[model samples]
Target: MRTIVITGGTDGMGAALARHYLGAGDRVVVVGRSRAKFDALLTSATAARAEFIAADLSSVADGRRVVEHLRAGHERIDALVLAASFVRQRRHVTAEGHEASWVLFFVSKFVFVTGLAAQFGAAERPVVVNTAVPGARADAIDFDDLEMSEKFTFARSNAQQRRANELLGILAAEANPDLAYVTWGPARIVRSSFAGDVGTAMKVGAAVLGKLLGQRPDAAVRPVIGIIDAPSPGRAAFRGAKRRPLTIGAHDDKDAARLAAAVEDGR
Candidate 1:
């Protein structure tokens, strides 16, 4: 049986994915911040194939804790799914001293994937799937203000973090030629606990739009399953079920390297 590691698997699309894999007889270890939510996800029927590790991924230390736990237990990882992401209406910094959204969406993901690279290399068919918005291109990373302390806005932070995730996929593919790195975008906003933390107007709008246009969490997770089950060459980015061409930023290499350095520094 293939072993899969999933972040943010307590709720939303991540939870749906955990159930899907458990149904297919794969071992799923879900890492999340909430023990209550994790308990809710575990049922008598699926408990045998599932495990949970509690972690608040908004900090680098917590990210490393997860990596260490996995490395100690599993020698090989068939798939690593980076599905934990959220957008906060106002900017908040974590204890690790980085923008909360950026940490959750990009920084922590880089730490987990890179920290677990050796396990990935040991696998027969290794795959890393990042469920972040695709092609949200950014010109470069602002070295002086990586956290956007100067003028932090939700839109700017979201765009920058999404771009960072895409660049991460490229860099990861370059570093680990044996692994398949895929970045996926669900395209439409769906009903999620994340919406509760946003502004009231945005929350209402998303809820309405979700009902009208958003794909259900189960439906949204299908493409991710496809990416995991069907191995592909190199790196690819997808929106929904279709492959879309990505626009790489001019300073992507420099930005990616800088980000990698920051992750290594554990900031």
Candidate 2:
């Protein structure tokens, strides 16, 4: 059986993915901040194979903790699914001293993937899956003021974090030629528990948007699962269950190189 590691598996789309993979007979290890929730998943997941690691991805130390925890038990992971992300009400700093959202979405993911490259290197068909937010293209990343405390807009913050995820995925593909990297965008999925963590303004905006255009979380996972199961060569992005040849994200070789370099510099 192939071994898989998933972050943010406590709830939402991540939890959905955990169930999906485990149901498929894969040995699944879920990483999250909630011990109670993780334990509950373990109890209910007897039909499928599953394990849990309580980890807070918002901190650099926790990244190390997660890696060590996994290494102690799992010798290798066939795939790494990075579904751990959070929305902050305010511009908060993580224990790692970086913006909480940025750290979870971009920095920690980069560190985690890079640190565990050796594990995937040994696998025959290792793949990395990153979820992208489609609306993120509207906002540009502000390297100068990452915290966004100056002018925090929920949409803008979400967009920035999404863009970071896409960039990181591309960079990951460039860094590891043997591994396939895939990014996916689930449009207007509302069945997920994302509403609980967003800002008040965001919650209101989402309520309005939901009335206009929102989809069930299961609708989003179809495409996400496709990317995880069948990653494309070069850089590929998926929407729904089908793989799209083209996406709005920057996926050129130069952009991917730059992303890799930036991630290395951050280390």
Candidate 3:
């Protein structure tokens, strides 16, 4: 069976994917901060193949630590789902001095792909699926102001996070031409902890929209499963099963390299 690793696997689409893989008898490793949630998930799923590692993925240091642990523990990683996410109703910074959302949403992905480069290559068919908006580009990312300390807003921060994923995926694919790197997203919001930091009003509204327009956790992971089985090589973006065009925005090759270097240097 394939070995699967999921960040944010304690809940939401990540958890659903974990359950599915565990049922198929694949070894499933989940990384998150909550042992309680991980225990509850294991108890409910009751799979001998399931495992957990507790870490705050919002911290780049912790993200690297998880990668090291995974590299040492697993010989190969067949599929890696980068689903960890967080937001603050207002600007919030991590102890690392980087904005919390930027670290979790963007930097964490970079850490895993680069740090676990060998493990991914060791697998027969390795794929990294980032649960993020595809075909979305940032209007601008100020190289000097990545932290957004001087000026910040929820919308602006969120946009940068998404845009960063686009660049990350492209750079990763370029670095390893044979690796399958995909950015997959749903058309409607799935009710999740994603709503937690957005404020009560958004939380309530998300529940409503989730009921009306969102796909259930199980439903959301189906396409991802198919992608894992036969992923389009190189880089791709998807909205549901439909492939979306990959765009690098106005940024050029130099910008992509700079972003990758900045993330690697712990910027």
Best by lDDT: 1
TM-scores for all candidates: the values are 0.93, 0.81, 0.93
* Clashing pairs for predicted structure model 2, backbone only: 223-240
Clashes of each: 0, 1, 0
Clashes of 3: 0
Quote the positional error of residue 12 for candidate 3 in Å. Answer: 0.9
Instruction: Rate residue 224 of model 2 by lDDT.
Output: 67
Which 10 consecutive positions of candidate 3 have the poorest summed lDDT?
A: 187-196
* Candidate 1 vs candidate 2, lDDT winner: 1
Error of 1 at 89 (Å): 1.2
- Give the lDDT of residue 176 in candidate 1: 77
lDDT of all the models against the reference?
Answer: 0.82, 0.70, 0.81
Off by over 4 Å in 2: 43-48, 134-139, 147-152, 195-197, 204-216, 242-267
